[model samples]
Target: MPTILMRYRAAALLGAAVIIAPLSVAAFSAHNVAAAAPTLSASPNTGGSFAPIVSADKPAVVTVTTVIKAENAGDEEASPFRGNSPFDEQFRQFFQDQGIPMPDQSPEPRQGQRAEALGSGFVVSADGYIVTNNHVIDKASGITVTLDDGTQLPAKLVGADPKNDLAVLKIKPSKPLATVGWGDSDALRVGDQVLAIGNPFGIGTTVTSGIVSARGRDLNSGPYDDFIQIDAPINHGNSGGPLVDAQGKVVGIDTAIYSPNGGSVGVGFAIPSDQARKVVATLMKDGSIEHGFIGVQIQPVTADIADAIGLGQPEGALVAGVNGGTPAAKAGLKAGDVINAFGGSPVKSPRDLSRMVADLSPGTSKSLSVWRTGQSRDVPITIGRNTGDQQ
Candidate 1:
């Protein structure tokens, strides 16, 4: 949806993370300090029956159905054969008079001529809070959630962080809803077992198993795109579903898949839970996140660029451009300056710097370790908020 990346939103097996909070990242009251939500994890040694894990987590997974206006749905199949629809009702008569017998074809269900967009989500709180991809409900006129027990409920959008492609919805269930616990995604290694549960192609809930194919996959979707790559066969309608770990805890949020042929080719991506925890917690309070920003364009410091700049080694982020009146400019940061560190932590790459700056709160002051003119120096700066107005 955002380039060749197919967003597993709507009805296709294609689509489309960093973007992780490090230890130094600010903390939040993500959840109340109470008893942990009951997560029924099955014995990993159970010799191949994931039924227990599925049974425990399935209750928390819900199907997210969204309704978009016809004009924006981009799914009009009026049929060129008809020679009418957008043309005119009068054209239909004219085309009919030509006696062009239409071939026998079953009428396409107006499939939401209102554009019914289907995706998946999971219950994160017993109080009825849900997490899904922003693309799932993007531009939707109405949203509905169907629980595991077949109970349908109208949902309200609590908040959405589109930069992360994550949205939080609130539904009022008659009783406390079943919930899933967050898992540590950082601990997952290649070949570690994981399960993806969701409604692929609007088919009833299904579960697929695979190993962690890779990690830190950046699809160039965005700067905060540190993704968990898995060969779990996620397809359309799996967007926003939870990627569960062996312990039955939610480790990642299924968001996109890699498919050049319009279906899963054993490659899928999910947002790490560590990052989602902070964003979701904030969304639960504020309607959106005020991401930290400093008007500076950056690129990785390749070895050639580093040598030319007289740096000891290829490292840190090189300032390519600095916006005027922005924090970087105000701090006297100029092109050719290499940001080696922030808040005393090494700024290893552009992606690293991106996640670092984004983790800080606006107005929070920090010192940047800058390598300029063959010398290292510290430039103090105040983090600014990216209000979509400022660069």
Candidate 2:
């Protein structure tokens, strides 16, 4: 899994951050614009006031506070003031001269300190089923959920799937709780209006509105990288918050953001609600998810590699290696074979194949289309339960 950087940006600033990679922006001419008017008009709202939607969805959003025990608190880096830097003494003297309190010069380690973190979550069911990011309550000794009405209640972790960065929690509410319904994230399109509700920077429920900046974004975070990119200002403490559509349906879960500094850069990523719903359901039932596995190392077929392999287009996943005694090996899958399709679904890239394979049920048989020695052929393989050891 790739490291996801968490940052926050204010909701008021909507400027696009400079991405290192060049993004293709489509340009429309006057004639094309006129031709697309009808289609554009028929499409969902690309821009509008999300006040009504936010008002309805805000109540379901809750603030998640986690307390990690001292034993679980990770090591902290040495501070500059604690080191023997020449400026350290001067800094202390300057503070004293300016009538400011002197900084703590204690050499005590923080191993005894209990760490606390704040994030956001939303009620998914009236019975107090909540959805949040796994990282939010990771290694937490205690969890608490604060409702919109200022009611705080202890929560228990029902299940967590770190691979998907999602967790399901159960709370005993006094009564039926406000809940949000999941929407079909597949129906989302770029430029569609979205509302992000979360407790950013530990502040109370904050609602930010923006458009779906992009879709099917893969930030190299995990095997399931189908993230919905939104310009909605989500910052630190917003993780696990719901990204609601214009109709107040939960379309995605705010997870990570791209930022050079520790703030949002108008580029935030969310786990699509459609994918999350399945995980949440499984977690609620089994308390964990078991991913299907086919033992094979794969890589994306680059244009140069594709040409060399006689493939006209850069597509599918190229098998780099095969694990012995595994399903792929038993099924006659070999290195250099390009997997074009799995279970009748076209594999667009290595990540696509990874996600498809992981979603399969273990011990199930599936047909795979492979390109080998300049020809395509179908091979049947039985999916195996992931042992949590394979990369």
Candidate 3:
């Protein structure tokens, strides 16, 4: 699979790159009128403060440290350094600058070298159930959860949904632990104030304030790419942290940041709580997630392609190809068919169709509306269980 540049710094890339172009709509001419800018009677922060919210919710957040045994330690293809060495690039550059032909040196085998990674997570239940990013503990030999009071407890992986970069963990706490409730992320609007709590760069818990910069952001991470884009100062170790709203409810889970320097640049992405809540519930019940699949390669319907296909507007998923023996091929779906709707819900883009299809249950029959040869038709398909290989 082609590597996607946008990824969770704490974990591996989830999926391939999906290019979704924004549709531009033309506006009709109307009578022009002057409007006045709205004004507030008082400042926007007249009665707003994040101190109380942070003080109450910080305890539920925890630092997650993962240890990978030496045997499992290896260099990632995307990483410039070899064997996770911090000075690999500097040493090579120094030798090159000195005009010295340095001989190739193999890394010395260490007996018990361990790679440690730090991330953040929040308690979702009082009985020691915690929610964190799947990348945080990926391939970890040992996992530990450190509470706000400096108490550390061994944690076991309950379930992980790599498709959504979410994981559920279980720990045997001496007593009931503090937990945070999920909030309605659908209600969050752009410019709404949000607070981020996490452990950045392995430091202690930190709080930062920012606004919801955008909604439904897709960094081509996975089929489920409905991310809440915020300007919070989340860094490398902030993965799996909670993005709380004014009421101190977990509206989003900090997952990835857009940075070239491996640091926060005021552009961070989070998994919405509504989606996280559904996945967490299933993970708690089932050991893994079973995604619904209808094998077909799809792309966005651009304006030029829409016009060529006689579509008035650029909408729906343009089917580029269909795999054999799959639900789409079995349902007689063709290459040129544009999926306008699935299971009675409209698909505005390829990502929307992908998300809708994956959310369905396997073995269930769904009515798919498609645009074929300048006309529309319905095709019924039996959803199939995704074995983690198909798109």
- On lDDT, the candidate that comes out on top is 1
TM-score of each: 0.81, 0.76, 0.78
Give candidate 1's error at residue 58 in angstroms.
0.9
Using TM-score as the measure, name the better of candidate 1 and candidate 2: 1
* Model 2: lDDT to the true structure: 0.69
Question: Tens digits of per-residue lDDT for model 3 on 186-224?
Answer: 999999998888876555788999999999975554688
For model 3, the stretches where C-alpha displacement exceeds 4 angstroms are 1-48, 75-112
308 in model 2: Cα distance from truth in Å? 4.5
lDDT by residue for model 2 (126-232), tens: 66777888767767788888888878889999988877878888788887766666777899999988878887766577888888998987645457878888898
Badly placed stretches (over 4 Å) of model 2 are 1-48, 75-109, 303-313, 389-391
Task: Give residue 86's lDDT in candidate 2 (0 to 100).
Answer: 19
- Candidate 2 lDDT for residue 128: 74
What's the true lDDT of residue 344 in model 3? 94
lDDT score, candidate 3 = 0.70
Q: Would you list the clashing residue pairs of candidate 2?
A: 8-235, 8-264, 9-264
Global lDDT of each candidate? 0.71, 0.69, 0.70
